[model samples]
Target: MSPDQIVVTVIGLAAIAFIVWFFWLGKRLGVKVAVNSSGYQEAMVLVKGGYTPDLIIVEKGKPVRLNFLRTESAACSEMVMFPDFNKSAHLPEGETVAVELMPNQPGEYEFQCQMGMLRGKLIVED
Candidate 1:
């Protein structure tokens, strides 16, 4: 291939890779967890690339307590926001932060970092 063809091929590959990663990352990192006896569904969410185990599954009409531990110092993961609940929290480096909420409806609730790069979801189901 010529120099221009090589460049075009490289760019095309990069775009395809990004598209696949962007769509699959969420499902790849998702984890379904049940609340423990202590009434909390806990997970350690790594914040470097995004929230690990981003998808959290739970029963509907029940109060949910989520603990997020941010292990990275990236500014993009400094804070977590739950727009559905009107909740936002600052996550200090290397600490576990708790978010308590009562989700009475069966739906998908989204959470993300301040810059919206790190993303998470709570799937409330029957």
Candidate 2:
């Protein structure tokens, strides 16, 4: 291969590696819900490029309140959906929106953006 071709191939390979690491092998931030004075398990999730604490843990059979603060104006981040709980919320830019969930059984659930680009997980424990 020519010198130019080699450089291009290397760059392409690097880009592919970055994408894989970012989307799959990156470090995931997890937050365990805390029971607030209002008696609800709550956690604040920052929304920008993605959910800050993408992994949320809470106890089953309790109310879980996830406060999502959208810091970016990206259209893809406007909405968050919890398919398992059939709950969703519109997150306005520069404002906070609360999405509540009640997990009667201990299991793992998924939450994502409207486009499913940004994703998160909710783990309900016994």
Candidate 3:
């Protein structure tokens, strides 16, 4: 009945809407990167409900660097692991952590959070 209550309700609805829309739209939108002059392909992935550009396509036999930025303070998003690469990094809130990987073969490599709730795939192509 109060203006304050109305504002709070509206904000809550907006947050829910954002979450739904993000998951729905993010699934189809993936970023591709090619090896730059620096000898690596660069891509920025956001860690929220999951990794943005949830799928990344990179050239095989080249290096790719994923710059992961953790915007959420959730504990689950604090750590990212790439089992196939034998690599893992602790992602601090509001900081961008770079994970460089070189794949000599063509295949799909998976990355995820500590809890395995967040998943991402990297497709290596010739």
Which predicted model would earn the best lDDT? 2
Expressed as tens digits, the lDDT of each residue in 1-29 for candidate 2 is 99999999999999999999998898876
* Residue 92, model 1, lDDT: 92
- lDDT score of residue 65 within candidate 3: 91
Residue-by-residue lDDT tens digits, candidate 3, 21-104: 886654565578977789889999999888997899999888889999999999999999999999999999999999999889
lDDT of 1 by residue, 8-126 (tens): 99999999999988788534445766777877655566666787778888787667777778787788988999999999888898888887888889899999988787777888888
- Global CA lDDT computed for model 2: 0.93
Error of 3 at 100 (Å): 0.6
Pairs clashing in candidate 2?
A: none
Q: Among all windows of ten consecutive residues in candidate 1, which has the lowest summed lDDT?
A: 25-34
Q: How accurate is candidate 1 locally (lDDT)?
A: 0.80
**Which lDDT values do the candidates have, in the order given?**
0.80, 0.93, 0.90
Q: State, as a TM-score between 0 and 1, how close model 3 is to the true structure.
A: 0.77
